[model samples]
Target: MTDTGMTAPEPTAIDETRQRELQILSEDAVLKGHPHGDEQCKNCLYYLDVDEAISYCWHPKLRVLVGQDWYCQWWEEITAEA
Candidate 1:
């Protein structure tokens, strides 16, 4: 018997507007240079380089986009927020 575990579909609607929004998010909250008092968005679980837009987060692969700043649920902290 094949064990076919149900899985959430990948995100697909990540268009230019979405990308821009997320980019703004990263710039505002993630890259605000808050002093590194906490983790930056770059190191979070949702954080992905511009090259790997096709990649999907294991926890909640539903919400996706090219850039990493795209917010979701499975995000993790790498360092304190600046």
Candidate 2:
């Protein structure tokens, strides 16, 4: 392979202990389907849509893949910038 100056960015490493902690907190927070009709992960500020049905939660406390219809207590509505 030719030596290219470009390189892929390194992936962020999450230690096992931290990963476990986050998982526990995620479970405790009841990360699941939306409880209300209007609020869902897709509309949340932390939600990064991967497709029509799935999205990744970018919340610092909850970095995980989530369904578009799923939601959590940390959900915050995305606001438009002025």
Candidate 3:
């Protein structure tokens, strides 16, 4: 049998397509420069990446995509990811 350890199964064609669509992006959106990086997104008073494009106080529901580096004044780092 071939060595499975060396080469993991690649994502299915459909899974690959979906992942490409789900990956972080900054299109027609702002790449916010967070003073706290991940800290901000995770600790914002209202943090949620649901179906809607979220923000500290702006961003309409499902109107825009959030940049991974986006941040606002209402940011905090409660955990390592934040």
Best by TM-score: 2
lDDT of 3 by residue, 1-82 (tens): 8766787667799998866654443322333555354544434434555234443333332233344455644444445553
Q: Over the stretch 22-69, how does candidate 2's per-residue lDDT look in tens digits?
A: 679779767876645687887888888735588778888878778888
lDDT of each: 0.47, 0.77, 0.46
Q: Candidate 1, residues 52-78: lDDT per residue as tens digits?
A: 644543434333333343443345665
Better model by lDDT: candidate 1 vs candidate 3: 1
Where does candidate 3 have its weakest 10-residue lDDT segment?
56-65
**Backbone clashes in model 3, listed as residue pairs:** 38-82, 39-82
Listed in order, each prediction's TM-score against the native is: 0.26, 0.62, 0.32
Model 1 residue 79 distance off true place after TM-score fit, in angstroms: 6.4
Clashes of 1: 10
Report the CA-based lDDT of candidate 3 relative to the real structure. 0.46
Error of 3 at 56 (Å): 14
After superposition on all CA atoms, what RMSD does each candidate show versus the true structure?
Answer: 13.4, 8.6, 9.5
